[model samples]
Target: MNGKPAVFLDRDGVINEDRGYVHRWEDFSFLPGAIDALRQLQQKGYLLVVITNQSAVARGLCTEADVLALHERMCAFLRERGIELAGIYHCPHHPQGSVSDYAIACACRKPEPGMILRAAQAHGIDLSRSLLVGDKISDLEAGRAAGIPSLYLVVPPGQDEDLSSLPGVQRVSGLSEVVERMFGSQAMPSS
Candidate 1:
């Protein structure tokens, strides 16, 4: 497949409230302006993919099937909003997990860039031209390791997090700020 630019996103904290390992649909709440921001990005013709670390599965908080179910619902909801996701990838392994099946250290986990690398190969995404927006420093490191050109660190709403000015890293209060800068006053689709 010919290569195309894609936007790699982190699920927790960035997309939904980081309310501690959301495995249920009822507890999943979209952050304020998240849907609108997503719509704007969708309109901009970017291949949107979700990359997340779900060690809850390894910690026995939930099952892999539960995560898949939640993602199915998420994609359906996005479709209702006229947005399409290229893919949703999660790392279920934890180094110190209680569950034996998912306890081993894996490469897909954040700060490793394994998931991004796999997604790029699977979807033919041009890593050099792609972008990653996540809420943690690990996310930035993963994007950097994957060679994504644009990386934005999103701070959760109302968080008093202070990050030292880092070269090649832009800090954002939320997803809306990134959307505003990337698309300016254009590409926002009516919700």
Candidate 2:
């Protein structure tokens, strides 16, 4: 397959309000302007992919099936709105997790680049031209390691993380800001 550019997104905070360890459809809420931003990005010819680390499974807070169910619902919700995701890759491992099966330090977790690299290969994505948008430094590191040149950090309100010192990473208030900056007002498509 020919290589195409993609926008790698972090699921929790970037697409939905990260109500810590969200594993149920009832608890999921799309962030404001997220749907429109996704629609615009897709209209611009970028494959949309989600690369996330779901430690809740390892922590025993939720089962892997629970996470998968949530993701299925999320994809359906987006598809109903005309935004189709190229892929959704999630890592369910943590070094200190309580679930032995998913507790080992895995390569697919954020800061490891395993998921992004795998996604690029599986989807024929051109890492050199792709972009990643996430709310954590680990997300940026993963994208960078996967050779994605553009990285965006979504700084939610009241977020205390100091990411200003990080070189080569741009900070935005939310998905809307990222969309506005990338496409410009003139190129923005109506939702």
Which candidate should be chosen as best, given TM-score against the real structure?
A: 2
- Report lDDT (Cα) of residue 168, candidate 2: 78
TM-score of every model versus the real structure: 0.93, 0.95
lDDT of 2 at 51: 91
RMSD (Å) per prediction: 1.8, 1.5
Model 1 misplaced regions, further than 4 Å: 157-166, 187-189
Question: What is the Å distance of residue 6 in model 1 from its true position?
Answer: 0.9
lDDT of 1 by residue, 75-108 (tens): 9999998889999999999999999999988889
Q: C-alpha displacement of 91 in model 1, angstroms?
A: 0.4
| Per-residue lDDT of model 2, residues 99-124, tens digit only | 99999988999999999989889989
Q: Give the TM-score of candidate 1.
A: 0.93
Which ten residues in a row are the worst by lDDT in model 2? Answer: 157-166
